[model samples]
Target: MILKYIVERNNKYKTIREVLKNEFKISSRLLTKLRSNKKVLLNGFSTYFDKEINFNDIVEVYLNYEEDNSNIVPNNIPLDIIYEDESFIVINKPAGIAIHPSCLHYDNSLSNGVKYYFDKIGLKKKIRPVNRLDKDTSGLVIFAKNEYIQECLVRQMNSALFYKEYMAIVNGILEQKSGVIDVSIARKENSIIERCVSNDGENAVTLYEVLKSFDNLSLLKCILKTGRTHQIRVHCKFIGHPIIGDTLYGTKSDIISRQALHAYKVKFIHPLYNNTVEFCAPLPDDFRKIIENEI
Candidate 1:
């Protein structure tokens, strides 16, 4: 695959290979291959390895090979089916399962499981998930089975018509029983792995209500006004109430293995049925144990 980047500043610029190696942390050999395949371009013009870059230039990249989506065979993975109709299907995704295939996880994803289920029923086309949950986070998920339903649900997501509620166990007892967290977040170090509250970050809002409190932990019902990557986790950490067991953003806890966050409820209007649909998943066993013991 080819990668392109436009120079935004007039400072000493790096080559395409150098930029990919430094910015994306990709291997040097892969960068060399991408350049050799004429997959890298600068300012809409194909150039050799020694191309000079200027500010406000538009870059285009071409891929030598296409993604082989056919090899994505179905795996007969077990799934907790919450709701299903002609238009869409909802699943209570278990923890420690990735939603889609990525660098870290190639197969054994929730998508693969969904595909396998559809294939078992003799459905050819694949279903597309309307939203995503982190690999370690578990709860309700919706998938559109066709393009018409996909477009409708995507519209609802863009307009915030879909309602999602999450449950999280944080480190400290929040003094405010209910409050709004309005913080702007942006990528840190140009990495998709980390984000931070920044002046130029995108606007994000979250409403949270404390469900229960303990000496050291508090369970919160979190609602997102604007969905952003790591929004809930980042906001909680910003308020000095980081989610328990979130190793990336806060201190890890022995009481919980992964981040103490779960999508508990989701409500949306079904495109084909033209009726409101709602689904909920109970807290995972580990999370329930923490509540039973701690709070």
Candidate 2:
């Protein structure tokens, strides 16, 4: 991949170093690698970092010129890919699949599946997930093809520019049509996986709007203001409308085997393309069954 930059007017940048640092936002590690690889070009020619340039000059940086070797073992597990490009891929991850390799789940994971797909397509790049969803939560998940794209997307995720929306089925009908849950959450004592609302925990915020109501359940649209571990689960419990089948925060249900939560949408600015991009994943079959009165 080649990144092209054209100097424009009203600029304070005078040197390549300034342009790279301020305009391009290149990391020191990647800059060092670029220097070693001799891939940085100015006006279609190799140039030093200190070389001077004028307005409208073109600067190009080549990336992924060599094949990358990753340790993640490839497997033939199937993937539901929604979108794919040279820089990234969006997958509709199903329930019961881990994002990456863990002690209990090593081969039959999304990472391994991505490795297999990339290998089959003859693309050599490491698997890098921009965000994660719980094992039981199904939704859209983004993965970058290279280190530069991964770092750029991660920076956006840490900022206010990235957005994630979820759809969930809660246990009870909410009194208020919509509301915000502003609370602090901390891991429960002596438990590695449980989280609860506490004054001594990190700040968490969630916005929710009731979409539809059923006999004993309510479908809700949830938007996360801050990403926390099991945030939606804990916040829904805090609001007295825990998600259905959430064994950790709420009681189990027969309608769904796992928590009835889905990451429905994601929106972000393209780090390299300079355009806004959004993706949506349709509700899984189990969620549709409950909403359509099939369960």
Best prediction by lDDT: 2
**Candidate 2 C-alpha lDDT tens digits along 1-295:** 8888788886577888777777778899888888888888999998898887688899888886665647788999888899988889999999999998977666788999999999999888778898999989999999998778888888888788899999999988899999999999999999999999999999999999999999789999999998999999999999899999999889889889999999999999988788999999999999999999997
Give the least accurate 10-residue stretch of model 1, judged by summed lDDT. 63-72
User: What stretches of model 1 exceed 4 Å from their correct place?
Assistant: 1-71
Alpha-carbon RMSD to native, per candidate:
13.0, 1.7
Total colliding residue pairs, candidate 1: 0
In candidate 2, what residue range of length 10 has the lowest lDDT sum?
Answer: 64-73
Error of 1 at 153 (Å): 1.0
TM-score of each: 0.75, 0.94
lDDT of 2 at 248: 85
Q: Report how far off residue 209 is in candidate 2 (Å).
A: 0.4
